[model samples]
Target: MTDPLALRHEHAFDIRINFDKRWSTGPVYGGASIGYTSIGEGSTVEGPMLTGTLVDYSGADWPVVRADGVVELNAHYMIRAEDGALIYIRNLGYVHRPLRTKGQGPDEEPDVPAYFRCTPYFKAPEDGPHAWLNRTVIVGVGQRQPKVTAEDPPDHSLFRYYAIR
Candidate 1:
């Protein structure tokens, strides 16, 4: 028998935000984010992701609502090396944050909170050149930096992603 762990390797990925649009309904804050990924090492797979976040602010003080968060992420990837083969990914996770304000103001700063971690499930064509992702389990770690400005439709949270071995 062979060691299964010995055959697996960890790869890191860099995520850059394209945009995030956030809104609030009563005490619930929710938003959608779109971004791209830069794969690590020699992988030619790169793509965009759309994520949705919901923050509950009913238990905090006025103005500055601090609470736990949950998010849903959906990604579509293209393999540049394999003539642009497509891959799909889905991720769901929780966010841990400190007491922070939502928007920027004269006396308030943007919420720069803690990191969020998630497990990503990949789906790829079995016959595709990069089909190995379909059978692999990947863990993702992310950092959040929420931005608020005076402009209309200010940029929201920015996140970076790293894949765990």
Candidate 2:
């Protein structure tokens, strides 16, 4: 069996931000952003595109109001293939929170925190050549929300090609 990791294309999509919250905020502090992009299939390719941001907010102190420490998420989705033709899929997003440590002794080192704790934002139909350009929202501590804009259309020139030996 071929390895899925190997079969996958490298950076088939180009994610650029018009303005990133991280740029203004200090490096260590957490923030959110919105992004836009077009999804395309290279040379008759067909499959759903899974896109989203991976966030790390463990370093921040917990919120006093909410029981949760901090919320990290990827508002993303999938596109379904239709009638062997390319279609423009609407962009959809969702929010997720990372799992936190429970009652543990201070002496013990907190277990290595998981990067993405929430469930995946899955777009159904899982196959297609669709274009979905929507504003993705990522929220972090202190109710910080950032917006990301897509500067350039994605280039799929170097997509992976496979053939029977």
Candidate 3:
């Protein structure tokens, strides 16, 4: 038993999911994919990374809801960089609801503010300048947006990622 790993981090980038679409396959029990967990269609992301902008999105989000009202989300997507480099990202995280009491239901959490956090894994070109993304440990903080007016969508959110050093 030796010393524990020292933790240090820096802000990496942020992904703004401006437009979102979703449909659930229904939650299945006793499996990795489970109920009422909505699947996100290819939502668009607009952000800069390593001086490049993420231009395209192609993938889906697989989510599972636990009895305790926690949402496990696995988002797998491919993004095209402005420089023509394609990068793959998989963000696995959870949306935490208010702790439920005995006999309470998941809907009871609707009034409580939710907490969302996730760790993102990346796959980038080995020899590319941004190749460092392949080995860095990253964590993301999520901020959800509720519809403000008639023109605003409810599915929008921004996930800011940070690289742990």
Q: Pick the candidate with the highest TM-score.
A: 3
Q: Give the Cα-based TM-score of candidate 1 against the true structure.
A: 0.46
lDDT of 1 at 45: 27
TM-score of 2: 0.25
User: Please, what is the whole-model Cα lDDT of each candidate in the order they appear?
Assistant: 0.42, 0.27, 0.69
| Lowest lDDT block of 10, candidate 2 | 56-65
Worst 10 residues of 3 by lDDT: 35-44
Stretches > 4 Å off in candidate 2? 1-9, 14-66, 70-100, 114-165
Could you tell me every candidate's TM-score relative to the true structure?
A: 0.46, 0.25, 0.73
TM-score of 3: 0.73
- Clash totals for all candidate models: 0, 7, 4
lDDT of 2: 0.27
**Residue pairs whose backbone atoms clash in candidate 3:** 27-34, 27-35, 27-36, 28-34
Candidate 1 steric clashes? 0
Tens digit of per-residue lDDT, candidate 1, span 54-148: 11110111121233343344433333333544555555555555435555564665366565666656666788555756766666666544345
Worst 10-residue lDDT window for candidate 1 reads 54-63
Q: Note the residue pairs that clash in candidate 1.
A: none
lDDT of 2 by residue, 1-165 (tens): 887556332222222112111211222324433232222232232223433221211111111112243333323322223343322222222223434367766676665453322221222333443222222221111112233356543332122211211
